[model samples]
Target: MIYVITIAIYLIGLVIIGFFKAKQIKTQSDFSVAGRALTPWVLVGTMLATWMGTGSILGNAGKTYQTGMAGLWLPLGSVLGIIILTQIAGKVRSYNKFTVPEIIGERYGQVARLLSVIALVLAYMVIVSYQYNAGGAVLHTIFTDDSGVSAISVETGTIIAAVFIILYTMLAGLLSVVYTDVANGIIILISFMIAIPIFLVEAGGFDGMQIAFSEMGKPEHMRFFGVYSFIDIINFCLPGFLLIMGDANMYQRFFC
Candidate 1:
């Protein structure tokens, strides 16, 4: 009940932000890129939020649980990619096109632009599907009964999440996206700040980690290259790492 109330309040706040920002969006550029006026802090917040999604949290964390320390490869790769992106980020922003296709068309020709758009749509649709699924899973977990009966099915939860996302995107465009991203980042940071200490205390401290690992019978989980072949490491790191370098969201934020 408390959780639901908190979520309700948070959502209400987002809606308000969207409705407020919607009034200011008079041009296509304003809607698509927040008039290219996002401040550094807001840009940082959105970029961080975009980069750290359910994949970074639950998916990679699960991998870490299974493979121990080897799971760091994916996120480490992403971080390294971001560091590299800093080099060309200025170039991206200076190109000053509204859409990625426009930028490509200008440089590569119409055929390349068409291919890029097709690829972007296909890839983004897949990304949206996963995002909806992740939101649904979180909602289902939140609404599940003590006996583990879900109040809402995953499909229903997904639809609800998708609707909210669509509504917010239509309502305020990049303005709402960036503002809500900053808020989301703050909440996530606070959650980790509060939870990590409790988790550490529960699992016992540094010494306790060793004891816990020993009991789990997977002592190698604490190892840097735990159980991962060289091929596995490369394979795990490359996709996410490379993807971030060319992600639409990151590029959009840079353009802003």
Candidate 2:
């Protein structure tokens, strides 16, 4: 009942926010680029929140669980991406493009734009599918019940989340997404902060965590740069860094 109530409240809040923002959306331009009027902080918040979704949360958690500290390098890569992006912020802002493909097409030509669109669509669809799957998993865990309704409950919860996201996004575009993302980021940060201390207390504190880690025989897990050679870091960073150098999302944010 508590779980249901919590989810109901969250859904209601999201719907309310969407409805309120819906009035602000007047055209495709407003939806797609938020009238290109986003401030720097809003742009940064949205980019960070969007980038740190299910793929970052669940995927990184699983990886950290399996490989210990070494798994953290993936998120560290994103920090580097942000730093690289800062250097080119001026250029990106100047481009004033909607999609990455548009920017690429303008810079490289029609063929580049066509290829970028194909790639972007595939990437975004896969991301959306994964978010759906993750939401279902979270709902199932939250509303665990042995009655055969767990599956149905989880699926229903997932569908509800998907519908909300689709409707909110469809109604207002990037403006709504960016504003909601800022709120979402704050919520996630606060929730994690509160949960972590509670979790630590429940798990028996720092000594308990140490004992647990020792029993798991993973002392090296605490080191962020452990086991990564210079060449390895370079190899992992090179392509991604280079790609962001020309990323369309970066350009769009700049234009806005």
Candidate 3:
């Protein structure tokens, strides 16, 4: 009940924030690009929050749980992409376009711009679908009673998440997202710092963890790329690589 209350308050808070921020959205630039006024830290925070989602938390964790060191492909791909992104970030910002499609139209032509927009819409739909699903999973897990009864079904929780995110994004757009992401960024940093040590300890330290892995008859799971073929490795890494490189959200942040 307490956990439910806390989450309810958090969602309500976002609604309140969105309500206030909506008043400030006087133009397309303000709504979509945040009026190009974000400083480095705010931009960084929004970029981090936008990029780091269930894929970073539940998705990556599940991969690591199943594949051990091989799971790193997801994050390692993103890190490599980010290293490359640092170079492109400045150039992207200079374009000062409202969206990635604008850049595509400038660099290529209308057909390319149309294709890019189509690609982004498809990618964004997947991202948002999973996000809503992840939110539902969170709620379903948290709402399970002591008797193992689920107070909220995953579907119901998903609807709740969908409504909240849709309303929030619709109400205020990028301005609200950036400001909220600032706090989310800080909280996530602290969560990772605290959770890592606890997880390591619970797994019985690094050496114990290795022994447990060996006992699973999957010692290769500890190796780089493990038993995966070169093609398999590339396949695993490509989705993340392509997604990060093409994400319009990051482009919007840089433009800001």
Best TM-score among the predictions, by candidate number: 1
Task: Please give, for residues 114-205, the per-residue lDDT of candidate 2 as tens digits.
Answer: 99889878866766777887887788777777664564466776786788888877767777778888887887888889998998898688
lDDT of 2: 0.74
Write down the TM-score of every candidate: 0.97, 0.83, 0.93
lDDT of each: 0.86, 0.74, 0.86
Off by over 4 Å in 3: none
User: Candidate 1: what lDDT?
Assistant: 0.86
Sort by TM-score, best first. 1, 3, 2
Candidate 3's clash total is: 0
lDDT tens per residue, model 1, 183-208: 98888889889998998899788678
Q: Itemize residue pairs with steric clashes in candidate 1.
A: none
| lDDT measured at residue 99 in model 1 versus the true structure, 0 to 100 | 78
Residue 118, candidate 1: alpha-carbon lDDT: 96
Instruction: Indicate the worst ten consecutive residues by lDDT in candidate 3.
Output: 220-229
Q: Write the per-residue lDDT of candidate 3 for residues 41-89, one digit (tens) a residue.
A: 9988988888778998898899888887777776877777778888999
